[model samples]
Target: MNNQQWTGWSSGAQQAEQHYLVEPRYLAGGGNLHHVADFLRASGWSDKSKTGGPLVFDSPDKSVRIGYDPYTQPGGWTISANPADGQEAWHATFTRQTPVEIVAGFTDALTRPRSAHAPNAWGPLQEQRWQTEQGQHFTAMSPDGGAWLQYHQSQPGQALWWAGARNEHGRIWDASFTASTPMHLIESFSAALADPQQVMRPRGHVPPSTRIRTTSVSVRPDELSAWQQARVTAARAATWARASWATTRPRHTTATGPHTQAGGRTRR
Candidate 1:
């Protein structure tokens, strides 16, 4: 298909195009993963390319290119492509977030590594896990969706690694990797936590909240009788009494009467 008219391709076409072009799919939106994938493929973008190449499309103003790179230690793919001459460029990345379960699994797998350093050398793997954790959080709250947000925020020409996990509430979370340290990953996580749907918002529109209330009623005669009986029993158990001495004393006692004390002595 011609590059200019390439956007018309469907999801199946896009998938086929990615196979033909060898480009990795990332940050797909508008429910058009395949279409976009096909477009990238027609332009010669792929996960294996170090630098993108130029391409021709139906529109003279449009130009496209794709590039790929490997991240350090924990291996991952970073793909970037753009339509420079067009109105805008599309770009995305695909990185695995090592889920907490996966991390534990990996750690267990390394327990009997062939080399002595293999067990202790899990730094790269650990970093990958951290990156996934950070990335997941970042993506969850990214203002422009996870893939695009991470791509735009990422340092040019670098892959972002991360670990993945399901939060306590069963939500997917990830940590990301960047240059120098994992601080950026932490920042992404914080941002994600603050606004989990940051990137998924409809251009300027906020999501509405949903609330639910439940009520239960019983109308059986037996249930009603039981309830009435319980109420009656409770009422009967409750009592009030005046704190006057005459009330606690014998019925013959009067307000002015003296009480008998110990040893049968009468006290006034």
Candidate 2:
């Protein structure tokens, strides 16, 4: 979907607190947001804040949002323990509950290639259909055969597998598979989503150690540019030095010098 529709999905109430973590799915419109807020209010979320917004539930212990944004993308909106200006504020990062099937699929996809019979698809997979065995119907949509859009639909209370694909040619497509264990998947994806860079770590951080770290380092635009340029120059210099060394290195020699002997005797 386009950006506006996507943002609407993010602003929906289904995204309230961390429920989106369990499902990690966004409603297509703002209506879901209202529905979520109403649900929270009915569920006894406090409206006593100065902003009169939903209160944090003790069980989950997280605030819920009750607002909208024009540029928010699906899976991008979040509720904080605090609110701003009598309205729900979205955090730059938030947590989600992981699903089991998604966890299984993600683990499987990473360790093994898709089965020969499985569809080699691309893009985040949406749940449209499923089989009793739990194997889902998937589709790959792309102009280049290198990428596709895919989805996996699982039995109820599962995670929808999702991600963008990359190859030698860069990112080619995004996709997701249905997950049987949603809570786990939500937990895992929420951690990744909160810190996109974490996924690039050699080994993922364990939950006990998954604390969010932030620094307030500030740099002027020019300083940032200079730092980037310095990095580029260093890389170029290293490449050039390696190439020069490769070209200048001496070649291997055979044992044909005076040190060589024909019958165990030195030949000078």
Candidate 3:
């Protein structure tokens, strides 16, 4: 069930369109560029964008690159880490449908430097009861089998990681991280994958091929949890802080004060 009022469409033509507000658990593929971009800017990344082209950012040391291009097929957002010697290191990409919060899980951990010891990539997913098979290869799938995360040995010393969702028809969207991708980064992605928060979608706008597998509820504004309410408050506060700072600071200034994750409190 969906609440028509929650659609937020004021135009008569838009109102006439059919939509259902669905809340998906595992395979919630969507993104918030503004949220992801803000986090990057705060992490000391520099923006190098043309007036009417793609959004691009470079790390402080020029070791990483992040881009958002509208015209790109399949995936619009790309992030890669490159070493100084010019050889490419690891990289991750996201289609427009991939949730930005999950992407943030990687970036946030990236900014906050951690110990060099490798963390288990499967730990977070295992906490959520996703089944895993470990051998010459590694694979994990959602309890319902709607989504999966896997690692494959691409070469003698190189490997690739991929995650995606599907239904009867075919694949929806997929994301990948190449070899040398930090284990902590992978762990962050796993934690986000196992998060309990559900993603909202318009029932009519959901993929035609996967619609039969969706699970939803009619959530009203009042139904949000206290923690979620606090996050909304923090987002409003951050927005206000950014606006006020813009008036007195340089154009490249980062917003100050309280910051909130894209959704509820991060599991990590």
Candidate 4:
């Protein structure tokens, strides 16, 4: 399942290592962070870290946060076979197990009857990965028209996904390289699992809708000055244009362009 070739381990090119590439997905979050936490508990992981992160599984061989968290390791989730914590079997433990298991198990749970509510109906339409003063994150939308899911890569192998109310409510799992196969899967998941009504689906089925408009935003009058408002309006227009372009463009885009999500919040 993993195609790892060691063509440049010491050539100052690509570092060679054995890893099971994880596929990212936009999942239905009816129960919020607690839902994701349940997955970790079921998987035999522990959220014992005082770092205010997701649950983790630690052993004699490895130490990895069960889900992904970008805070500690940017660019991806925190997956270290040779952790600095003195875990000797980092390679041995991770060698036999891949991070995909966590993703797969979590996604599988989303398919359950009470999880998504109705049939799958939301997923990633297009994603823009960029960096800001705060950190590196992504802006994802649903192809079928629903909500916006914004996420960030905190660490090398971990990511945190939330809506415009990302931190307002619970968290979701959303991460993967911008150009990887997992990216495609994630896009599909966003479209299939994104709930527009902000209500849990019935039997995990997302409701159908022809009301396909860009998500709306709510800004308090006192939050920005007149000039800032004008700039923000222009930025919103540009973001719409880019999203439109994304529909016809490639599935994965590498743009160092500036992000337009004010305060990193996604509207329903």
Please provide TM-scores, in order, for all candidate models, with all chains considered together.
0.18, 0.21, 0.66, 0.25
**Candidate 1 lDDT tens digits, 50-98:** 3342221221112222222224433332322243433233332223332
Candidate 4: tens digits of C-alpha lDDT, residues 1-268: 2243323222333322232111122232222233334444443344555567544444222343334443543322333333353323221111111123323333423222133333221222332221112337655544432335455576787654443212123333333322212333344334433323222212223212223112222222232233234433544465467457858764432355555534553432
Best by lDDT: 3
TM-score of model 4 vs. true structure: 0.25
Candidate 3 C-alpha lDDT tens digits along 1-268: 3233433322233223233433344355564466667666655678888878888988777888888887767646788887656455888886776666677777666655565777988988888899998877799988768677899886689789988766667676677888678788889888877776655554455555444444443434333233244544554565467567758763332256455524444333
RMSD of 2: 24.3
Model 2 poorest 10 in a row by lDDT = 20-29
All candidates in order of TM-score, best leading: 3, 4, 2, 1
| Candidate 3, poorest ten consecutive residues by summed lDDT | 8-17
| Model 2 bad stretches (over 4 Å) | 1-162, 165-217, 255-268
Predicted structure 3: lDDT: 0.67
Using TM-score as the measure, name the better of candidate 1 and candidate 3: 3
lDDT of each: 0.27, 0.30, 0.67, 0.34
For every model shown, the clashing-pair count is 27, 41, 1, 43
Cα distance off (Å), candidate 3, residue 82? 2.2
Sliding window of 10 residues with minimal summed lDDT for model 4: 89-98
Please give the TM-score that candidate 2 achieves against the real structure.
Answer: 0.21
